[model samples]
Target: MRYARFTGLISVLVANAIPGTALGQSVRIVPDLTTNSIVVFQGVDETAHFYYVPLEMDFVRAADGKPRLGVQYFKEGDGDSWRVAVSTSIKPAASDSELAALKAKLPKDNNVTLSPLVLDFASSYVRFSEAKKPTIFSLESGTLSAGSSIAMKFEFTGTHDAVLQALAASGPEVGVMAIITPDASLVQGEELVFSGAAVADLFEKEKFLLLNSFDESNAVVAFIINGNHSAEAAARSWLKSKLGSPEIGKDDKGVWRYGWDLTRPELLADLRSSPKISLPTFSNVEPPNKALLLPFGNICKDYPDNIVNLETGTAGCN
Candidate 1:
């Protein structure tokens, strides 16, 4: 029973991380509500560099129902693989002594050390928000630079795999962030390329539109439906009428899922008009457990078993 309760919390928290609302094109500044404080973007040219700074505390409830402050960064233009995120926990520190203690506990190996601006950025950025924008800033390389925030540059000593392993082992005692960079030699040649935000945009629509997998060749788009059996049945039947037969399943938390094949032209036609699922506003949504990480690091997995979250000592599987 305790296991079941933990799993239920995991499901809700995981769902909460999903961006509650769509972002507008005009520099949608959001607090990085997770651990990653400074996001560093490496450019195609060795000299090109840019960053996004979150200027305030974006607090969200973890699975344990405790509030965690986080920040997020965004960059426009084509995608680049040399993106690194650095984050730490400072809000929980009640005093200067406590903050120093926490900083002392940070990892120094693998070139992972606390930034001098870590505390200042944490304390000062928390003061700025969507309502109260930062007065001083500049746009560089398609990213918003909060000029006042401390600049951070991290150097990892090993390969991407080794760095990732080191990061996973850092634990909650020290805040750790992940960098998405390729290990291959070709990475140097990797230039920014356009990725359709169609999927991301569709997520905002909350409609029964096609949710393609990372490999866009797949024919099915799977979506989560929040409702009881009757509601699920109604949705399923309605979908069947429009798009024909679909694979239906329920998650461990009893959320309904509908998977439709896009290979069929007729289904594709109907899918464009499939009804949108009305979701609760973002303000009402709760954040997922920070301890519990997303399965395969993908936020939009289908089954709960694919989702994993870390408990105190043991790892909880979806």
Candidate 2:
């Protein structure tokens, strides 16, 4: 009746399309935004290679005045992991009683709950093969989170702001959204190397040591660009100046990475036109040249002897 368990390899492409398709009448709506939810991807082929990871968090309005991006679910804890800081200068957006009065000034945690996320595309799922549509899909009214649940009936031809305005007219140069909070005074053998706009000007000059009163829900922000490949293509034309064409990937230890999701508007006006310390300051920024730790997962395996290069992802500074 309800199944939200979906694990890897698109679940063997939905169990090999369940013995010759006949369930998915054609489910579409692919604007993954890394996993802000809205990916009923089983086919009707817009380009299928389908695989996903963003687990629900769609709010929109990431440009034009900046700050209106939702669905950043990052729950994991003990040493650390939490999420919730969607106040990027609030205005017309930010309801739900203004994000519950800004999550009541943060730092209380009854085991975390930021609230404001709402995606229930009838329990979303997406594991497509060929043949037809064996089963396992459901999406009728978005606003459901707690991802991976199996349900059926996905044929959303358009909407979700028209597939994010057709993926912002197929262009992506988005850069620097770094907001990586967590530093329990970080000294378990310290390591926070720098390169290319030095961690976005060290989050705009030590953003109060990456704050998190009790729940920023394991704060996360992307636009990660590690080096080699012309210093990750010169840190993507020095933080998105060229725009679009950035699919580079390889983080589970194999260095060399690249990421996006600023939602392109001249790449968010070239990352809000200056202020990542007015860019350029890489005196060989280190670790394959100007690194910012992106050797992949476990946030670079929780710093296993930093100076990155988990099999060539490069970084060093003993």
Q: Which candidate is the best by lDDT?
A: 2
Which runs of model 1 end up more than 4 angstroms from their true locations? 1-145, 150-318
Q: Residue by residue across 1-318, what tens digits does model 1's lDDT show?
A: 000011111011111112231211111111231125322222122111111222122223358643332221222245321222323222211233533554454444453322211111212111122244322222111111122222222222333333233234321111222211111111111111111233234433543333223112221122222222223333334444545555665544896776543345444444445333332111112322111111112111212222222212222221
Off by over 4 Å in 2: 1-113, 123-139, 144-192, 195-318
Error of 2 at 166 (Å): 43
Q: 1-318 in candidate 2: lDDT tens per residue?
A: 111221111111222333353322222223332222212232333133232223222223345533232211222354333321111111112234534444454446453333211122223223222333323333333322222222222221232333222223221111111111111111111111233333444344322211121112212222233221222333435444434444555544795555443343454454446433222212221111111111111211222333232223444211
Root-mean-square deviation of candidate 1: 26.8
Residue 249 of model 2, lDDT score: 51
* TM-score of candidate 1 against the unseen true structure: 0.15
> TM-scores, in order shown?
0.15, 0.15
Clash statistics: count for each candidate: 10, 29
User: Candidate 2, residue 104: CA error in Å?
Assistant: 11
